[model samples]
Target: MLTRHFLALLFLLAFAPPGTCGPVKILMLGTSLTQGYGLPPGVEIPALLQAKLKAAGVDSKVINAGVSGDTSTDAASRLDWSLADHPDAAIVEVGSNDALRGIPPAETERSISTILAKLEAQHVPTLLLGMKAPRNLGSAYVRSFDAIYPRLAKRYGTMLYPFLLEGVVLNPKLNQADGMHPNPAGAKIIAEHIFPYAKALVRKARVRRTAK
Candidate 1:
């Protein structure tokens, strides 16, 4: 058994590509929803995603950099700190607060673009999660805000999950009392929806593990 274990280590050392670190750190940058808001511990979006990924056989540590009430601009301002972990990949989920606060879509676009640029420069794979503007925000505002994610994704050549809240938004059972943030049950669904895109990010992050 000792010799077998030693051989395994030797094999890995011989085959593993030279890189700063392995593809195991996954950072999630977002707001209250990812922070769990009113939900209990270990039930937040990032946490649930981590669990899901583990179940899928992708062992990763998800860094939940979610700050309640954070807007896209706010998240952008802290991008450097968030990247300090040197994560192999990142999930960009801010902008919901910006939409709720009526921040200009162009401003949100610029902030998110900056974040994507920084991540690209660092060679960290990123998955941008989209959010739709409130109905009361009017058609024009809705159109502008709703379009930012795809535009930024195209510009940055990053993966985009069209709508983060997809099947959970506005559903009473899936949301907390506030109806904005998702409940634990809702978070599971969201994680499932984003899993495919996240898997792509993981695959990209793992490339460094084998590439010279």
Candidate 2:
């Protein structure tokens, strides 16, 4: 019986899909910021993150699922499709478009809540990246919108990066001509700030993968 079991294990290992026993897949689900917007292909946050991980000796595949102009509702609607990749973990950076479009904060909250719930159901470790509404929005609106991320993070027990554009939001050097999406330099800053949190998610993924 021991000999047969050992042989079975060997066979499974031999035929396992590439990367199955190696890097974990991390899905970056967000908007144009995550997609790189007008930035060049290799300068996007996902690509920068992949490079960061490699440099740090962490093996992982960062999948970019960002879509320009996608609101929180849009993200919620396509989450099932995103989950089809069976990501070991996720980093959610949505809601900016909702704020920009003046969508109700409650609606944004609901959509993001649904996203967190779905990810939790799948046992995928998640990192929620918060977005502050434009200050031009009334203080009340800003308060409500800003509160969504921490509240959802607490509720879902997920890691929370307070702001996706932290340290890169207003500076002209960091922003593109549109002053919305980050420039390559801005993207690099984002990747650096997000690296530690993402690394934590990778660790959690590994633990969960091992348990299974």
What TM-score, over all chains together, does every model reach? Answer: 0.92, 0.92
lDDT of 2 by residue, 155-182 (tens): 9999999999999999999999999989
lDDT per residue as tens, model 1, 121-158: 98888899999999999999999999999998998888
Q: Name every residue pair that clashes in candidate 2.
A: none
Instruction: Assess each prediction's global lDDT (C-alpha) against the native.
Output: 0.88, 0.94
| Residue 161, candidate 1: C-alpha displacement in angstroms | 0.4
In candidate 2, where is summed lDDT lowest over 10 consecutive residues?
15-24
After superposition, which runs of candidate 1 have C-alpha atoms over 4 Å from their true positions? 1-23
Clash number for each model? 0, 0
Please give the RMSD of candidate 2 to the true structure.
3.4
> Could you tell me the lDDT of residue 154 within candidate 2?
98
